[model samples]
Target: MIRGDLHELNRISWNAATVRHNSHKQDQAGFLRSGGSTLFPEEIELLGEIRGKEVLHLLCNSGQDTLSIAKLGAKVTGVDISDEAIDFARKLSSDSGIVGSFERSDVYPWLEAAIAAGRQFDVVFCSYGALCWLSDLAHWMRDVAAVLKPGGRFVCMEFHPVAMIFDEEGVPKYDYQMPEPLHWDTGISDYVGDSGGALAVSGAENVSEPFVNPNPCAEFPYSVSGIIGAVLDAGLELRIFREHLFSNGWKPYRRMAELPGRRWTMPEGMPKIPLMYGLVAVKS
Candidate 1:
């Protein structure tokens, strides 16, 4: 059960992420990596070429992926709670001459308005660390259903909740460091920095801005079943769901044997585990 105090903490988390997006253009760019089969690109491609399609992006951070879609000839509107990220996305859009719309609002409110107006789109897209921040999964799914046209697609590529269970040592465990989930909390017992625990990217010195969260919300573990349940509950028919251990996008899991593109496999005796999932569903 979500405690009442969490509302304040959630706001702080959004504010901190906004601060980071505004200050860390370079860092964000690096994360995007532009060009190649990163998570965003790979996920987008999995949805098939989006050329000339209309896409609505929920929790679109900094609009990098949104803009990328727009470049592919899809009319895209990216939404997020971070005013700073929206501002930067707008600037990036203008600089690149990509026709993309951006909305600075909480997903719930924006989705409510869209539903009330009976607005819909061809594709609803969300990705990367997006789903966990949401407080209500059912409502989020409802919003996706509300905004989708008949036969429209809903696509998401998120860090697997299984990943959230791992520690810096790569062991699986849970018990957040604080009472409630903090903004940066990965649902793990400890902090793992940006790139696992090995690389440290914190504050302005290490990143664009210091990531600070006064209140961290809880991260409910999402297994494949959990995710599929949300999509089905949202009134979508499951089309394709792909779980993989290797993705050129994240780069960290590149060396796994089960993954494509690399001749290397997991260490000779390493345990085989799933790190993430990519899913696509259709509104019927």
Candidate 2:
């Protein structure tokens, strides 16, 4: 499929997922009202002390993490492809009294406009399931570099590509070194709220009702070298690269054990695999 068509399909699919994602108790509006953040501990530590910094959050669904960063005293601007997600994010920010800005646009075009407007940020932050949506990592990283000030930092924490090759049954379904984009026509949505339960709160009439997506989506599975090499080629110096054995959410395999922080790992006697990774690079 063409990149534009894939993006549009993903937009629709993600918009559908956003409604359910926002309603879930794990990401409930009230939880955000009480100063809860969706950020993992590793992400928080890597972005240590963002007070008074200008931060750009790419693929910031519903602005949960954006507001969290705002609470840390950073000026934040969140960019997302889904209008519904941005709308809910704006509402959440308003309802929670956290100050931040949001824009609805594909990341590449948004970054291009930011560069044209001479806007630069102290930090460019992205994470979790964000990178897989892009078809061109080099262009993406170049734009990332373009939007950052000299000596600025780019921090990304995401599901490791190695883990993405496995199916729900823990079998390897794709090549870890596959160079092309993968397409999936599965009608099921991957949002946490789809796990089955009533919403934690009511009165979200303005938001769309949750529903399953029947559309297909395409994603590019990039190797660690491909990702890091793109960052380096974009003129950013690598600061840190780390991998973790646990995922950030529910296990893909039923037999896996749940760990603290909503993470999941393999059961006893099973070989451990890196499920998540974080990268920090600086623009020199």
Worst 10 residues of 1 by lDDT: 187-196
Compose the digit string of candidate 1's lDDT tens values, residues 90-123: 8877766667999987788788998999888999
- Backbone clashes (count) for model 1: 9
- Give per-model TM-scores: 0.75, 0.91
Tell me the whole-model lDDT of each prediction, alpha carbons only.
Answer: 0.63, 0.81
For candidate 2, report its TM-score: 0.91
Q: How big is the positional error of residue 127 in model 2, measured in Å on the Cα after superposition?
A: 0.8
Segments of candidate 2 deviating more than 4 angstroms = 194-211
